[model samples]
Target: MTDTAVIELVEHAPAIGRPLPDAVGRALAASRIVDAAPDPYTAGQWVLRAGSKVGAVTLNVPDCAPVTVRIVPKVPIARLFFLLGYSLDSRGWRDEQVEVAEHRDLLPALAQAAERQIDRALRQGLLQGYRDAEETSLVVRGRIREAEQIRRHFGATLPVEIAYDEFTTDIPENRILRATVERLLRLPGVARDVRRRLLHQRARLADITPLVPGQALPEWHPTRLNSRYHQALHLARVVLTDSSPEHAAGALRIDGFLFNMNKLFEDFVTTALCEAYRGTDHSCRLQDPHHLDEARTIRMKPDFVLYGPDRCPHAVVDAKYKKEKPDGYPDADLYQMLAYCTALGLPEGHLVYAKGNAPHTAHQVRHAGTIIHQHALDLDQAPDGLLGEIRSLAHVIAADPPV
Candidate 1:
């Protein structure tokens, strides 16, 4: 293998086709950054990140510059790393099972967020251990062979299969979590302290098998009080099952993970708004379901619905990943917001979009005293600023009437 195959080019927050990393390998084997063709010998596509996102970029033959390689994520996808961290942190770090020294120096991005999460989860899982080491029947060197030997014993090797209970970290869930942590441990860029913690965690979980993808997510509960485990279980579930951390490369098996910006935007908005409305008259919901007719042939699902004290929709809101066009707002979005307001018999609806140069505007429908308001949130802003917008939006929604 060549240097290009062995070493992946590191790109830091570059725009698509704007800032290109040095071209090292032959045409297509250079860097993973996506760009225009005949330009440089780089990977087929670029690892373009607008915010804190990490994923594999899939490409067509046309997108390839005669030879394009794939990039991979060692742990979970880049998207979840920060959000998970923020979620855990927002709860006053109550989710932490073990004391993790803050990593102020580490890039608060993809690798750090994931390593911190996995390291803590694995450590906590070990401290509390599985609910029950469920008696596993195994053939090993032991004191006694409880079950009858199925085959004739070889010279001094009569260890028959026997069922026994033990407190071991070598379980399926631990194995999966262990493998993910080990993968991050092997990555070259992990910080010194973070890497130290991960190495220790890997040693702790050394006995667990490195399970492959598609294994069942084992069940776990927080039976112990001193150590919190729901967080650990959540972290394990994320690395094991989230959509962004998927493999697009087959034989080469390079990490090609992707986070859908549209979905991420919607989820973030819904979550922030939900958090703000806690202990209020309105309860925020995401993807609330609805039936269109008596037979239920048609279904209407809105992104966020503000349910009032009566448990009926007081107002409805939709999140859009794109900006308002310089010419006008998207007609389809307006129609959809109107339908939600009418269905719920509310006078107001809202459309939230990524911040653009356009000023915020509101549209008054022709009849039924219905109106739709539009607001734009800057995605690049700090999390507090973005959540502040959601808080403001929640206040507006609360002032609306139901039916």
Candidate 2:
């Protein structure tokens, strides 16, 4: 009882407080995590379920040490669309085409196409009625009404007579008549007087929304809109329900509209890059495939190839509209630029991403005494900041001794 000594040993898991790996975090940030939960005892570790896929992450924590922890992201197919240019808005499928294909989910794209087809059919029906009236002078007559008429027969014989009349047959005249007659009948206007009863009847049959004056039919119209909508919907349904390449191609055309968003982004970046590097003795060449003599084939089309001061290869940059860096290292991008560098005999290249809040990164991989540098340009930053970063890069290139 006099001398009692106790030594307590505390064992703790590795610093579970450490943030998740960069790749996992990026994927999670871009995706929708379905079920994210952690054990109370092992708060650092988490089991995450995301869109038909599941994954786990164990944070690294030191013995009994409190450290900042970042949740790991789950990998799932749903994240694919976020990686692409599609985004969510209040409207149902704001950028449906891009979002569907970005996720590589053909079903939604096909469904959208099918819906478009239905709309197309409706539009076509409307326009066809107009065309029929114009071409054949076939006015649509509403239900004829029968009125009792007295006729002289053996006595006063009662006969049923119907009222009907004809009007001008020109397409424009018919269109006006139809529109006015329909409008008047709907509102019971003075234009529906008995004097013009027959004309009104004819107009009612041919009534349609008149085409705007001097305005040619729009690519999208009442008829075309409904018809194309339905056609697109049908085609989409066929595509989604089938695995045939034909169906896939049709779905891909719908997907093309999505890439248009990226095209717009690319154009903006291209313009920015051009403006920043103006007066630098650089020429911007687009889609010029550099031939790799050894490979005996066209290597790639660098989006923009800038010839620097003294006619040196200044920079080779390719614009990517992806929301997140794929595979963390931008390897695909690096590889693409490397091919350009090798074919152009340049020492370095640049990979410009449309989004990022961080400062630009310069990566150099030495090969045969030539340093192939891959630089990242974050276009989301202020224009001046971006311009400054670009200018700094230009200076760096100028100072580096050609390897």
Candidate 3:
């Protein structure tokens, strides 16, 4: 698709009166970057509505101009990065340290920050770690797999199966960094300078093993030996986790980088709340699983479940990233929180939204003796202000006694 043929749409806003080529429409539908439907008000026109996902994606079909659709998130690009960085590594990421000053868009800013972090991580040279390997070898190095040796060789002594630990730079940490660099190189909107730096990073990782496409990523543990890689790996994990690279849409080929704001909000809220409880008697569990019914048939997971020193749940919270409606925050959210409170046997529950139509409110369910509080966080505020809100909420949660 030509660079000039770009179509921009805001998150949760429908692009109306703009007729899309049938192929492009199909491509968008397949890419899942947005919801595409025929506009009822305008004949022969299409309506493309973006949901929680926000990023730039290019949808292509044969014999048509490729249409690059950019979905801008409701939150500012810098603030979105803060949410992402903090969620990925709460203690390491600082809003002022991210440095998205040069790039106003999400993709560029992310690419830049990722490249910088990766470069810093490699300044001291690639980290080396021990990796377990099992292979057929001419000679045993660590230990011989006698069972495998006999099964494959039928008692032949020429070759043997062996298991060993090899110390190498091609460990999970390097592989994750390499995969993230490769992912950034393939997508659009990366700055030319950033692309050069990413290429250099790739070269530094050239000897490392590339991650397999359909296989689970190799796991890495945090230790003092690889402490320098913590920040870079956190950013790399964020890039690798929240993106869709190449996927087919019938004849069209789609490539895009997207992030789900819903998940980002949830992760940030839950993680920051946990941080708030640090050094305190209370502990916070993220995505705490519990059954809603005594039969243990219906499972429920609350975003944040605060437990007291007695090891009992004191409060539960759910994070919601949504568009403000005309009347108020949806009642369905209140219902869900109520269910969590009832299931957790807590006196009250909380619902936090990115923004809300009305001020903070609470609902008391009659006869149930359960209260559900709805709180709206102003994400548009500075990071300090936003985090202050979380601290305030944490205090409120601690102040309430469990019934």
Candidate 4:
């Protein structure tokens, strides 16, 4: 629980339960991530283990991360944010970047990102505090609801939908972000002293979640000063999606916070490779697949399929966050890559593992008529270095197979 670490949740990994101070333990009880587990000690605290789902999370509080009874995990939120932020930027999420805190983890990191916007929002005057929109209703009216109510509600204005001009902070976007901040503030690890301040500041915002992303965002004029609000709203919307909200009996409960590095790595490599191959004779397609059977029920999806001069799959590449040992690679991965090669009518496929462990090597599966290349990319390398690995990877995937 050092200042700089976040919790890393490995898929199906076990964590051990440990003792905690009574206050800390009681506070943790409110969290859905940590739970009671079989323990040898009479004190009988709890353990946080990785769930069946694979993901990572940065915590604003200590002793969270909801792992198995035997695990003590620390994730590097700063590193992950840098990688994702880069990918997001390339995908057109541009902004004045937020600084990564030296001592805090993910949720706080998120809070920090939003805090700047929140401050700007306060200065600009609560976005929901501005002008009120006009509306119409039967009883209290800008216009008549008689015909509309007659057609829809049998002409009853008593139980009627009223359209009126009212100043309200209950709008969808504002509600979502406000709720997120309130939820974060209530979590265990958030600094206790900041809670009162944040609550008072956010008092103008009613914590609610009636609106989410797929609904259209409130449009803002593309002017210079309006940038902060837009960026704030965008960050709010993005964070809201990852942190799904649950409400029960007047309390907001969150399913533990986690980010899946597997998907992140897959996307980064796939997208970066595509960018590298831009303007080249060959085209790079990600998650493109061919059917494994005539029925099309089964699919052999490869992360990246590099096309060559013939307009066919020159090579199939798949990314792996957690890889097997070099001596004995995972059979499932072997089977998968082999299928990708066979279905795509290619002779070889490449599996990219994240940890910078083994040297790049190749193996041929028995009677499969295809060879599998295991390439390791060191995620600890600089972002540019990471991209360089993808660039070199392109040569291997796009080049001719060793006959």
Candidate 5:
């Protein structure tokens, strides 16, 4: 078919006013709609065009009626070459119709698809890792094993065992190992097993050195570690130092260990939000702290701020990893959300938390004649349920006429 006819088939096959040619109709019958057209096409409209055609085309949408196309004679069929070439090269369009095959550089698209798959797998792995950490209590068990092993191995060679009534504990295996490795590298009389294990652990955790045949493992020449370990160490140090009562109670206190939890919560919230509003013209802004100069204080950084179609601030959402009470009265959280609403000039803010501690609740508080609504979201439900709650909240915000 001519390029114009082919273009028309693709363009008008999705519309209500147009009829597709017989060949285009066959393509439509075979095509699977990946993305549905919003606002224009009626329900049951076929948005994809695929399969083989025999000259003319017929198109139909279930409630909107159908149209027929007459094949134009002496058409160049150059469009066929483009379609065939694209279909041969593309990945996402593998199962799609030849006519609807999206032609673009395969490398970038493949890379993107691979990246998305990897990210999804990573998220799944992280979640499973947390669960495994909790369930297996691996760190405590591993520490105990290391201590026992050290006591057994070094009890005779070195004075590393701390004696007890019927049992003995190693001189805190990790510290002893660190000290022994430091000393052995200086001298030469270190146990090979001890040095080997320590080196292995360090390499696994710190990317210390490359292991190759016949080359002696390098001594513990410690420099600053990679960004990942450095970040972990920094957070750990903060948590260790700031464990005092005052720091715990302070509003802006940064609990370094909680940073990882914060990141996980952010990921969960972003995923939940995107799933909830899959096709909507809305986007989520994360970890952005909005300042209100009038208040003369830095307001709480919301976990997420959702924007509406017109680029206006729509709603603020905070995802709390902790559980809330059955009455849904998290006073501090409410106050924080109020601050966000005031600063953002939004009508509502959400506080989403893990469920089972409380039933869902909503509150409307009038502040300076503006009604600010507070909502309790239950994370214990399915992801789709969480998304539904977000969609409902967005609608609630939209339905409220300007205050």
Candidate 6:
């Protein structure tokens, strides 16, 4: 096995085992982006298989030089960005804004894009907005908490507990920007220039309270006042979602940014479907929860459930993004969708998948009398065609007869 600092693999690459240094193999085995297993046919060889995650990560092995593992996605990089942006905000996202024609790697491209947007957001200076605050004040303010004063102060009049809204730059929007900048700085592969610019943004937002790592982010609403910050905030959320500094394999440290294609595809599909139903009488819920059994213990959540004007489930659909095998579509997915249809008391269910070897197909369960339809959405086409496919699916779903 040759010693190298980098290893490149494609998502769902063929299962051809390759030789690797023991330390590298161990480190790869510990990462979540791929599965590393010992090769049964070849001695001292290991197979690294990429799953739904795509991006680069640096694995630190004990006594060995750091190795960076880059998993390339099946879809084109530009399309991947489209999926991400559309998922963030379907109506506001403009793929032209995210320029990635020069970049091939996910981390550097993401870092560059994030830095540019953050810079644009801070160009006019930090945005100021009203934030609700609560504290004990010596002088009376907006409103006094009478119950708190009686319980904590025992009716004392010296200090009063008050709640008020104050206009300030230290709001959720700025804090999110700062936290995202900090996160980008920690990850490897960021261009030096981009890193420097992110630092500047952080300094501009230094006064804002930094979000605590691993805690829920502070809430912010969309309005005319904070319109300029919308684009930047959306990118910040994409960077922070499913990213953490705590990923570790015992003593070996793993630090990098990754996006789960499974989640991205699901979000884009469900959100697009919801958008298609915007003005229609039907309503859609993403991840609608239900129970499969009489006791209500076997809980299941379908990717999407369309509700009609009667406020009852009209259709059920699930999104799947996996490499299709030559044999046919996976039976397990059909089974799961069947379960969803049964639980929702619907006569039919739908399963959407990324384009694969198998085209759209349907299955009829014998005796169970349930029909499950499988649809494929080709992601390689232009955004208009991609969304057009979703619109067609929406029409079919809405027109389906209910049980």
Write the residue-wise lDDT of candidate 4 on 183-212 in tens digits: 456544445544665676577564433445
**lDDT of each residue in 1-403, candidate 6, tens digit only:** 5353777888877755767778778667755557898898888898888877888888777778777778888888888999999988899999988888678888888988888888888898889988889889998889998999999899999699999999999989999999999989887778888889888888888898988877888888999988888988999988887754336657888888888888889999999999999998998898888999999999999999999999999999999886345466657788899999988999999999998824699889999989999898999899999999999999998888997
Of 4 and 6, the candidate ahead on TM-score is: 6
Indicate the worst ten consecutive residues by lDDT in candidate 2. 250-259
Model 1's number of clashes is 14
Ranking by TM-score: 3, 6, 4, 1, 2, 5
Off by over 4 Å in 2: 1-265, 294-296, 308-312, 321-330, 354-359, 376-403
TM-score of each: 0.65, 0.34, 0.92, 0.66, 0.34, 0.89
**Model 3 CA lDDT for position 107:** 83
lDDT of each: 0.55, 0.39, 0.83, 0.58, 0.39, 0.86
**Model 1, range 182-293, lDDT digits (tens) per residue?**
6555443456777787787778777776765656655544445424434554554444555433343433222334344456567667777788888886777789987656
What is candidate 1's local distance difference test score? 0.55
Q: Which candidate achieves the best lDDT against the true structure?
A: 6
Candidate 3 residues 1-403, lDDT tens each? 2553677788777554467777677667766778887777776677887888888877678888877777788778888989988888889777776788556577888888889889988999999888899999888799998899899999998788999999889899999999999988977778899999999999999998899875667788888998888888888887777466566746877766888888888999999999999999998888899999889999999999999999999999998886345456557777888889888889888888877533578888999879888888889899899999999999998888987
- Quickly count the clashes in candidate 5: 13
Off by over 4 Å in 1: 5-84, 87-90, 93-108, 117-125, 130-166, 171-173, 183-200, 222-238, 248-252, 324-330, 357-359, 379-383
> 1 or 6: which has the higher TM-score?
6
- Higher-ranked by lDDT: 1 or 2: 1
On TM-score, the leading prediction is 3
**Residue 39 accuracy (lDDT) in model 6:** 90
Q: Which tens-of-lDDT digit does each residue in 175-294 have in candidate 2?
A: 433332222232211222332553534434354446453343223232442333332322332222212211122112101111122443454455545655667666566566677677
In angstroms, the error of model 3 at 176 is 1.1
Off by over 4 Å in 6: 1-4, 16-19, 41-44, 132-165, 244-250, 323-330
Candidate RMSDs in Å, in order, are: 7.8, 21.3, 2.4, 7.1, 24.6, 3.3
Error of 1 at 181 (Å): 0.8
Which pairs of residues clash in candidate 6, taking residues 3 or more apart in a chain or in different chains?
none
